[model samples]
Target chain A: EPEVTQTPSHQVTQMGQEVILRCVPISNHLYFYWYRQILGQKVEFLVSFYNNEISEKSEIFDDQFSVERPDGSNFTLKIRSTKLEDSAMYFCASSELLAGSGELFFGEGSRLTVL
Target chain B: GQQVMQIPQYQHVQEGEDFTTYCNSSTTLSNIQWYKQRPGGHPVFLIQLVKSGEVKKQKRLTFQFGEAKKNSSLHITATQTTDVGTYFCAGRVSSSNTGKLIFGQGTTLQVKP
Candidate 1:
């Protein structure tokens, strides 16, 4: 079965440095999303993207965070300056446009560790 | 935004015993989805429940959506060691523009052989 895939399974960056997490959602999926889970915490929604534009975002998705669908297959989340609290497992998910059945498939996730 | 709550943060069951997890949402949901994440792994889609009071079964697993569309349950019969993982219930909020998922805290299941 086709699945969502993310690059850089694990990343380590300096506290003030920038980091970009990349994801390639299923080819036919139309809606994409980014979620994060802090250690021992619930999964939090960060942002959702559709039609190459942002649909919704949470408070955690502040100015420092940005998402782009630069190409048909690539969805990226960039953090301008990483903070220690921003270190977590970032997951990328996608769903088909089918109404009433918006099942999302998630990637293995990129573990971001900022020191 | 709607929030999903799962009961029993953790569950320990014998290999051949039955296991069930319950999920409740603060508001009505368009649909409820179930996911599983193994230790040190990513979340994998298990099933999605739509329609009020709908019940679906897949092999040894059974899923139910509450009549009010605000709750769901996943039951696994004859649990095996492979069933040890964290189960999450995600609710789909119907917005005019887009649909987003609100995930529950999840219930970690430990199956002892």
Candidate 2:
């Protein structure tokens, strides 16, 4: 089955450094999203992207966080300055534009670690 | 934004016993999705329930959506050791079509052989 792929299975960065996580969604999917799961916590929605623009975002997705679909296949999330609380498993997901079916296909996830 | 709540934060059962997890949404939902995450693994889609009072069954698992579309349940029959994992119920609001999933805290199941 075709699946979403992400780079850097794990990353370690300093508290004030910039970090970018990359993802390549399923070729035919038009809606993309970014979610995070803190250790032993619930999965939280960060942002959703469609038509090259963000459709919705949560409070956690503040000015320091940004997402881009620089190309047809690549979707990236960048954090200007990483905070200790920002360390979590960041997941990239995509869904076909089918109505009434809100199934999400998620990637393996990128574990971000800030020190 | 709608929130989903799952009951029994954790469950422990024998291999031959049955297991069930309940999910309740604060508001009406357009659809409810179920995902399973193994230890140290990412979430994998199990099924999605749309429409009021819908019931769907897999080989040994059954899912139900409440009549009000605000609650759902997942039941496993004769659970096996392989059924050990965390199950999450995610809901999508009726007003949104952007495919954003609001996930619940999840129910972790432990099966003893």
Best by TM-score: 2
Q: What fraction of the reference interface contacts is present in each model, in order?
A: 0.56, 0.59
For A41-72, candidate 1 gives per-residue lDDT tens digits of: 67888998988999989889999999999978
Q: Which candidate is the best by DockQ?
A: 2
Candidate 1 colliding pairs: none
Proportion of true inter-chain contacts also present in candidate 2: 0.59
Please provide, for model 2 over A1-115, each residue's C-alpha lDDT reduced to its tens digit, 9 standing for 90 to 100. 9999998899999999999999999999989999999987788999999999999898899999999999789999999999999999999999886323757888999999999
Interface RMSD of each: 2.0, 2.0
Give the CAPRI rating of model 2.
Answer: medium
Against the native chain B, each candidate's TM-score is 0.96, 0.97
